[model samples]
Every structure is written in structure tokens, then in C-alpha cells.
Target: MAKRIIKAETVQITYREAIRKAICEAMHQDERVFLMGEDVGRYGGCYAVTKGLLKEFGPERIRDTPLSESGFTGAGIGAAIGGMRPIVELMTVNFSLLAMDQILNNAATIRHMSGNQFGVPLVIRMATGAGRQLAAQHSHSLEGWYAHIPGIKVLAPATLEDARGMLWTALDDPDPVLIFENVMLYNMEGELPANAGPVNIEKAAIRREGRDISLITYGGSLWKTLEAAEALAREGIKAEVIDLRTLRPLDDTTIIASVAKTRRAVIVDEGWRSGSLASEIVTRIVEQAFWRLDGPIARVCSEEVPIPYPQHLEQAAIPQAEKVVAAAKNLLSK
Candidate 1:
């Protein structure tokens, strides 16, 4: 009898670097994986995540698409249907609306409409949330919009581990996955677990445990929620922070369990109050844990207005640390 040895491998890197690593590794693993978007090739991406990728992968796989969002978006869908794994970067989710037909109509509905004969193996990455003064047009949280679609998997990678690992999982999935990377979280540094490989796109992860309140949030708002939780700790308030990595297939079990213990929840979302992800989450709580509640559910969401350009006003427009704390306190009082 002969014995065979099996070995595991992994790497550690920053959030931005992790994204590049996953893309490069996935491309190396499969020839079908290709990237297309404005400035993704020659300019090295707007946020520099795909920097130097074009030089290594060449222009064919590392395509520099034109500014026509709708046209190139449709092209990406067509390429995906033609047996290619196309990663389309929309620059920002706000601009993705221009290509809604290509995404929602084609990429998201193809497999179901075809009677499960075909799967749209497409990955769409975009910078989302309100910050950096990009204002109303460039900065908007559209994850809810993508999550609303049936065939798409919407992911919000709030940590470096998920940032590196989710891409692989999303690419491997047999349907379209939208990866939203908050602009403020790109530079955040954290240790990547040695065994961190592919993360599930359908489950939520509890980042911190507490029994007083559940600070639920995802993407850019995660940091702010954590900050608010830290402050609450000083005043002897316990907060269980939940990082909702995926919005579409939301982990209701984790959320419901936390809310059941705390009997209170404050959802922090960087989107407008009305018709936002926060609203949907609150609704879920009402449906699942209405009897378990100790007080009325509360939400700390962005003001219902265009994101202001001024730094101070911009801070006021979105959910900040203080805002989250206040919301949590208000809920606790009720």
C-alpha cells in the first residue's frame, strides 16, 4: 500500500490586495475568467484593485471597456452566455442602473427563463455607499436593488477575509453575484485567517456577541456600527454586532437568534430610509421576532436626500457612529 500526502495553501494580504489576489488566482485557475470595465485595464481600476492585472493578463482578458455602461454591460452578459466568466465593474452602483436591462433582464433571468438549462456565471463588482464626497451620483447604496432581483447573489464584504474569499465563491456560483465594496473599507487592515479560502455567499456572520442589542449592518456601515457599539460598551450597554455579508439570502436565523436574546435591534444602513435594505431588515424582524421584542425596532439610515458634497454635511447625510448610538439608545428606551 502507498501513502499519499495532501497539502493546503493560502496567502495574507490587505483588502485591496486580497481582491487582486483572488481575481488573479481565479483567472490563473480558469481561462474563462476575464475582467471588463472602464479603467480596469490601462488605468488599473478607479480604486487600483486591478492595478497591474492588465499588464499580466493582457488586453484580451483584461479589457478596458468604453464609458457606455449599457453597451458594455450587455456585452458582458452576452460573453457570459457565450461560455465566458466575465467580471464587470460598474465603477459605482449608481451607474449600474443604466445597465439594469443587461443585469436584471438578461444576466439575472437567463437561467430561470431557460428552464435551468443555463447558469449566468457572471460577477459584477462595484464601489458602493455614501462617503468621500463623491456626492449623489457616484455614492449610493444600491445593494438592496440588486438583492431585490431573484437570480442574483448580492454580497457586501465588510472585512478583508470576505473581500479575498467571496470573489472565488461568487465566481464559482452558477449565477450572477454582485460584490459591493464600500469605498471607505478598501483601506481597512485586518488579519486574514490562515485557512480563509472561499466564504459562503448565503450566510451571515456574527462579528461580535452581546446580549443587550443587535447592531445589524453590512458594507461601509459595519465600521460605524462597530464604533457605536464600542461607545455603548463604555456606558455599560452590550451590543451584538452582526455583519450581514450577504443581503439576498439573508441569514435570518442568525439575526433572529440575536434579536431574540437582545429583544432589541438597530439596523445601520448607508442608504436612504425609505425603500432601503434597513426597511427590509426591520420588516423581517417584525415578521420573525415580533413577540420577542422588548421595544419598537429602530433604524439608523442615510437621510432621504442627495448625498451632500461638503464633508460635514456628507457626514450628516449618512449613518455615523453617533447616529447609530442614538438610534440604539432610543430603541432601548422604548
Candidate 2:
């Protein structure tokens, strides 16, 4: 058989071009790979990430599923079991709950339950976090909930590179992987490497460095925390920002090192304060670096309420740059 090649000229060439590249590259590299989800074909995905893909790969490879979350989700799991690589896109994580059994119980457990005999090589992409005022039904950061489960990988791609690189990595793994793209980051522009380089699913990336404090976060909160750090600089406070790229592996090493140096930490998460990954991160610092603490741990999290329809209220419900700044200052004061 002749080897396959994707012409560099074929790239989409835009801010979200990398996402399309990731999908295209995977589909081109492996004949087993295909995409299935609501509006993934003719509609080009909810955010158009899969735009033009159906045309290029054709409908068989780029399948547009029905509104039935559980049904199509279950179908994806079955296809993966039958030796096909399926990238199943849930319009949003909120809708994925209806298919929870297929994901949490089926896709996540098949490998372990079979004593590693049968595995699910499935990649599920979903929009996560609050922004654009989609309200409670459409917006929810449920990656944390999924992270709590075993036998699956949870990824939060905060940068353009990860947004492009993660899909290939996820598809290669023998187990299921969930890629959560923050709605707020889809259009954000950044220079992606000519070649997305090797990415690890077990490590965290430190987005910024400083000594006064550590702003630990991931996904949508990363931008806000970095902005807050910039604002704190004028006051002589240097804040280090860490992005927890893989929520499941929970890179405590990187987080502990930063907190150990700064002696103070503030976790900014879009999820509510209680029982959140933010709380888990703070607890880790307290457990590993409590003696080095210069102040009580602080957190800036979304308010405990269902997302609202009004734009301003939705803004108020989630963590913002100003709130991050205030939280950083409060930690500095103690």
C-alpha cells in the first residue's frame, strides 16, 4: 500500500486551523480513524472545529449523529470496541450527562473489566466552562466530575498547541480520553509550533514564573490568572501561573514546586468552590507545602449557582480577571 501524506498547503490556515489540522492529521494517518457527533458533518460542529472535514474525508469518516446523546455515545463505544478509532464529539459536556452510563460505565470500564483484554480507543471532544451566556443547560465544567472516574484520561487544552496536539495523543492511546475545550478559548489566537511536538498526558505546564505567589489553574481560568498576574506586577508582586493540563494525572510535582518557592498559592477555577478540582489543588499544597506557607491558601472560583442567561449575570457567576486580582491581593495580605 502507498504511504499517505497530507499536503502542508491543505491546512485550514486560521486561529482554529490547528484543531482542524489535528483531526485531519489523525484521519489521514490512520484509516481506522473517523469522527461522529451531532452536527459534525454538514453543520461543521457547534464551533466549526470540524468544518470542511466531512467534505474532505466524506460522510462515512465524518458522521453527523442525531440528538440522541446516549444512543450515539453508546454507538461510539461499540465502534471503538470493534477495532475502529472514533472521535465522538458531544455538542457540549452538559449534554453528555444523558450519556453518562455509556461514558462513565461503559467506555471507562470496558478495559479494566475485561482484564485489559478489551479496550476502548475512543476520543470524546466536548465544549466546557461558562462564557457566551449559554445558561445552565448548555454550559457546565463537568471535566472535574469525569476526572473522578478511573480508566479514562481527562485533558484540558488551554493553548492552541494543546488544542491541536491533544487529539492525536488521545487517539493513539488504548483507552478512552476526554478533551475539554473551553468555549472562551476557541477563537483566541496564538502561534502554534510548525510541528506540534511530542505531548505528554501526565504532566502540567507552567505558563508563567514569579516568586510572590502561585496562581494555579487550567482551562478558561488560565487567561484570567495570567491577566491578574500582569496587574499584580505593578505592585511588585511576581505571580507564577501553572496550567494543570491533564486534570486526571494531577501533576502535583509542578504545582508543589511553584508553591514551595512562592510560599503562597491561589487556585482559580471556573467550577464552584466546594468539592472542586480547585479545592483538591489547595489541599495538595497544604499537605505538601504547609510549613512553607506565608499565608492562608486562597481560591477564586465560579459562584455556586446555575449559569444564567443574562450576559452580565453569567459574567458575574464565573471567575473574572478582577476577581483573580482581588484574590491574589487577599492572599498577599495574610
Which of the numbered candidates is closest to the native, going by highest lDDT? 1
lDDT of 1 by residue, 1-334 (tens): 7796764554556789888888998899999999999999999999999999988999999999889888988888888888999999989998899989989999889899999988888899999987799888988887887888899889999998899899999989888889999988878776676567787787888888899999999998888889999999998899999999999888999999999999999999887889988899999999999999999888898888898899899989989999889988887772
The lDDT for every candidate, in the order shown, is 0.89, 0.89
RMSD of each: 4.5, 5.4
The sequence of per-residue lDDT tens digits that candidate 2 reaches over residues 151-229 is 8889999887788888888999999999999988888876665767447778899898999999999998889888999
Against the true structure, candidate 1 reaches a TM-score of: 0.94
* Model 2 alpha-carbon drift over 4 Å, by segment: 1-15
**What's each prediction's TM-score?**
0.94, 0.94
Model 1 stretches with alpha carbons more than 4 Å out: 1-12
